[model samples]
Target: MSKLQIESALEILLQSLQSNSVMSKTFFWNYLKVFCKEGFLVDLQTLSIALVEKQAVFLIDSIACLDYKAAQQLDILVLS
Candidate 1:
């Protein structure tokens, strides 16, 4: 795979996936296979709830699929 494709895959995972739930190892490993055809790997051992929240925050800031009013409501809920 090209560098662009690898970067695109990682961006999608880091920006688009949900955060308010469990992340199966299989899910990540599957995507890893698609982008990393060689020796690359994800450091699963370093994952934590904080990491999930950080990713969620990134997803929220991107505002890719949210309705404006709904996004506002969610922001309120998150702050609350």
Candidate 2:
């Protein structure tokens, strides 16, 4: 895909994510990190694809933006 096409697709995804009800927006991102750490690449990709189908979204927390609230642990999801 061209640069513009990729940007457009990401823009659509970002807009869709903005509309979803986020239960701790970082939930899925933290889950992704843990999954990758534990070597669940295939499982994570499969489940993420399924969630994207429903427009589910996760906003990752960055260390540079750390604050009192950010210090609190985010909700982590464990998939069996």
Residue-level lDDT for 69 in candidate 1 = 43
* Local distance difference test values of all predictions, in order: 0.41, 0.36
lDDT of 1 by residue, 1-80 (tens): 34444345556566434454456444644554443344222322122122244454343342324234434544554555
TM-score of each candidate structure, all chains considered together: 0.30, 0.27
- Model 2 compared with the native: what TM-score? 0.27
Model 2 spans with C-alpha error above 4 angstroms: 21-80
Model 2 lDDT-worst window of ten: 70-79
Q: Candidate 1 versus the native: TM-score?
A: 0.30
User: Quick one: best TM-score, which candidate?
Assistant: 1
Which parts of model 1 have CA positions greater than 4 angstroms off? 16-18, 23-26, 38-80
